[model samples]
Target: MSVTETTVSSPLPPGKYYFSGNEALAEGAIAAGCNYYAGYPITPSSEIMERLAARFAGLEGRVFIQMEDELASICSVIGAVWAGAKGMTATSGPGFSLMQEAIGYAALTETPLVLADIQRAGPGTGQATKVASGDLMQAKWGSHGDYQPIALCPWSVQEMYELTITAFNLAETYRVPVFLLGEEAVGHLQERLDIPAANRVARRHYQPGAPPFGHPDPAGVPSMPAFGQGEKLLVTGSTHDEYGFRRTDDPAAHARLVARLNDKILQHRDRIVSTRSYRLEDAEIAIVAYGFTARSAWLAVDELRRAGKKAGLLRLRTIWPFAAAEIAALGSSVRQIFVPVPPADRRPDHLPGNHHPGGTGAVAWPATWKNTCARAPTAPRSVPAAATAS
Candidate 1:
């Protein structure tokens, strides 16, 4: 597949313009009602901070700070958001590891914020410039706990532009931290992004002069009062009740608070999860993939179908609430499911034992079917030639 050029027929509005993935992220933050950004420079992710710094330089009612480290960076952003400003921070894998504790804090406190992890190869600083989807497991379980986070993976430049906006909206609407799970390729790739006008940008609004945590609507999402709104607010990481105060020693309070945080995202998974399907109606075999791997799978599927095989592609855009229902529906008719694992240092040894040799490479599939419904161990699987016909 070829990279398409992004075109612009007209100039942008006063404060809006076309941008690349990096610039699109910055613009999305601005559109999402973000007024403050704090982050440290890291490869494959620094562009987000750079663009925000330049754009927020002269804007009133906005601030951008370059902190000493990723820990302080995330801490400051959380503080700013609670103080009544929409806040965000960006970093790569190693830095993301550093921010795990703080991210858990944000999740527990119900702080609405956006986090962008432009992923790179790593268990620990493995490769700064190389691209890999190694962070899939990390993004879901990075911050040690049972919390559901709204995570969106963008495969192209345009999605990086659009999904970042959606991430922030999800954060505010659900009162949870939303993640923009970007890969190095998408982050660095330059493409034309048609940014929507200011009025077209969707932003969550607080009830006029509403008190902090004051229920505004049935969605359980309150209109957040900005800091200095003269509203007395309590924010803490410990298990808290509806009012956001700490309930340190109470087991029941902890249970209810924890359940609420998890349910807030899981109950609304239908609204938060999205996937792109191709030729699924008649497919007899399906390939499940996400992010950059989805692109390769799409190509493979098209080649297979042209050779008179029934194959389809399921591309997951929302990675975290794992689109299980959609995958189950797609898998119902298919005989086999091919999950392409990108080239990595640690090969998954649990695949089912079915293998076929291609001209120069061998296509393998797992032997036993592991339903995504349960947290089953990864099993060895096989990919039939019909599934990779080309």
Candidate 2:
């Protein structure tokens, strides 16, 4: 057992204890400085809220609210953030579907928050306890409009913990809603997780009189000022000026405001996108995957290698700002690129549907089976990974 020091000079527990992915997510949120968690209980994702409910009982100023419904759940999280607290919420398919409106509000208001979707099979009341990777597309497009979303897909229990912390850091850094897309298998899988020391301290970047929105720091992200901060701020979903005044009727203002929102994420993409290139060097075929489906892809790729076939995997750590350049490069280098999607996602021309907010939808995920998000088989730019990212 060894302890790793973090940026905040806090101490990580120096031992190993078996923990489920959902439990690790709770611990990670706490470590990342999340003090407010409001959520409705949903299968798979319920463990996350449940774990936090018990943990927060002993921590001062930390709150765990079992909201009456997903609507109330998202509202509580948004309210908590406005009051200068780090906020987080966890849910599955149905709850995720219910959260779209608030998700849009978070994006339009540029609220720094984290949402975790421990995906299960869906559309309606799919499997409750069964593992599924169904929410991959919904996490991106479920919210409306043109906004860049930062979504992290974790394949294992370790990644579930690490990525949850990363999601918080990114949410604050970008002043955007960040999503942690965890499949059911990873959410409930028990494994030894070594708790890492706390590193990040959540905070607002506002000065007493600075504008609350519309000013993109050189980093391309606006420094956010929460309510109750000394700054006089007006936060709303309507198109607004940098000073937070609405310009909903002005086409130019509307265009510029929306464009800035998109540009803040797209223009400085490298800062927000992350991917794992596995054995890509000199490989002939590439397996592109994310979330739970990535686990099977890796195994299949590994098995093919033992049989002496050149193979590799491109694991998507960040799905929203999908790794277009990397995927494009693979298109040129590899003889074949395989994306292992679930049977429901197997329909031909399914990639476009996933990319279109109105097209088909993010459906079921594979548990001990193959699940995946589709990339273009030939044209990298033509294929869409997480289409509704904002």
Candidate 3:
């Protein structure tokens, strides 16, 4: 059968429908006005590319290319973005690793793009089908630079759809790369997705003479000009002046450019970081979590409350530009904090449960947890790891 006819609602219309998280993410990209997609097929994330290809096949002005590898896929997406098209790519852990260099380049150039990472078990090609939130640290620090990235974590199929659109909007607004971090479980889970009739999409503003790489305000986002726009634009990954001239050995220029790239996102973090509180108002204990684990954490909070424990949930919708302020605020009012970490996680510091709230803390894990709480360096003085939910 043709991909268009066989796929689930290619270019889905505005309505409620049953969809997998990966499929919903593809539809969300369409709804967000993404016109270019380049990606390699990697298990859980492959479905997103498949859906986008099916949709692009039936549409005009949209492009889809199955790149030979993740390196080529990310490069193509970057090129498309510079060519004035809303572009994106999807990949899993191994592919994500390969794209780090290009991701750093995109950050230095302030390229606006979206990347969906459906994480699987891994340090290096661990398990393709098994679920794990192992890419949490890699998404933030993998590029090896002072650049800041916006990453959103989705806990359900519906969130996978909504957050994908949010990822595009954030990318365009900040002129930076954005990541939609999903896990194998959520990406493959089937659930209801409600599509709205209209979405508030951000459109990149182009001004002819404005400097594409620098602005007077440290946290300001410069107007982006497309390649064929007759503007004398020079794009480079090296340290550069406001006009994008190469400033290889100029320390001042390098410092200024690097600082702005970070401040633009870090200073405006209030707008980029997103979190949702569940029964936090009167609770004495707070459970902070994100991605797939947040789903179980939410349930655990409800169960704790039923047992006369005043428990609450703080769900992290945005992972990067870490919600430090929110976590601190929640900590001040709570007696203890509980954070659920993925079972048998290979990286300890990358664990979401390691966020130190400056209070007594507990690490929640499933029955299969092989790591101890002591391994978490930033975690607050901890009690024994508790078996919370499966």
Candidate 4:
């Protein structure tokens, strides 16, 4: 059967189906082969648990656990994954903080798991009800070491559904933790989500009896063996070689293993990174943003274009690995690249510098022609523009 046909859902008899973002995520997970969920209830994310619990109730081999806390939640999910089950968890900012250590462990061990952080304002419990994109940096580097995570940022309810499936595919493909980074507004927003048919869903499976970390493809992503596949698997957080054995004292083993784990995602960035471009072809000014910030930036771009100004939009869908090449190519055509600087907490600081001739402009909302151009370190000079009313 064709790949699309294999995962495509049979057409539903002409009827209407309405779902909230949380429900759509649950449906997406079920379609993506997720059989386990371990998470604690937290604002803006608790509905995901509720929906999954109800959906998985009568399904055999499916497990849902309400752990005592977020840390335990992630820890349990990791154990579930090791037991040969596809596992996941959902949380908001505060709970996400508690789960950081466990997330780091999953990263170190090259565990395939999906984590959804429906973010809220906070360093520690800032604003639970308000919307914010402050977790962008954390999603990429929340864990304490030099590890890479495939992160998907969804702006709307439909994207929330689509990205959940993409997150699982990335997790299984890279054999590493994947994150769905959403803020309060997007996570809680209610909208119509197009649920793809089962056959359209992509499922990742291991070669029967394959070694846990054995690479069957040119990329270092190994064919992941399930826990009960009769393989004597030894999984650990310590630096290990391809054989999945602990080799903490071996410098070469450490370097090789770490590089492979990180490179597996970085090497395939072209296939992984996705963005939405609007009026970018010949525009002189482009606004680069993601999540809710992108929504506003797109609106502003539309308004600017309507006013005969040369404006376009570059909306990011995959936040990690930074999409540097694509951004650089887009920057080459634009005069000024305006990036909506989200609230401090959600900003992606490691994003590569813009290579445009006019440099990068960081714009805060409701301001017009108020550009702050920071030249690259090797560039000739910096240009600052006085704030003008929008």
Each candidate structure's count of clashing pairs = 19, 4, 0, 10
RMSD of each: 8.7, 6.1, 6.8, 6.0
Q: Alpha carbon lDDT of residue 316, candidate 2?
A: 85
What TM-score would candidate 3 get against the native? Answer: 0.89
Give lDDT tens digits, candidate 1, residues 1-390: 011123222123434345667777777777666788999999989989998898787667889999999999999989998787789999999998999999899888777889999888887888898777777667777798778777888877778877877787777777788888888877887777765554233344566554344243323555555557765667678677666677788998777667767876777889889999898788876877777667677777777777778888888899887776665565456766677655652344321112111221223444332322122114545544433332
TM-scores of all predicted structures:
0.82, 0.86, 0.89, 0.85
Cα lDDT tens digits for candidate 3, 201-307: 77776677988888889878888989888996799888888899999988888899999999989898998899999999998778788998888777777877887
lDDT of 4 by residue, 1-390 (tens): 011213545233222357777777777787777899999999989889998898789667899999999999999899988887889999999898888898889987778899999888777888898777777777877878778888888888878877888888778767788999887877788877665444245445566665566554434777666567677788887877666788879988777767777777878888889999988887977777887667777777777777788888888999886766666676567666666554544233433343212334323232222122122112212222221101
Question: Clashing pairs in model 4?
Answer: 6-199, 7-199, 7-200, 7-201, 8-199, 8-200, 9-197, 133-346, 134-345, 134-346
Model 4 TM-score is 0.85
Query: Which scores higher on TM-score, 2 or 3?
Result: 3
Ranking by lDDT: 3, 2, 4, 1
Best-performing candidate as measured by TM-score: 3
For model 2, give the 10-residue run with minimal summed lDDT.
381-390
Task: Indicate whether candidate 2 or candidate 4 has the larger lDDT.
Answer: 2
The Cα local distance difference test for each model comes to: 0.71, 0.75, 0.83, 0.73
- In candidate 3, where is summed lDDT lowest over 10 consecutive residues? 1-10
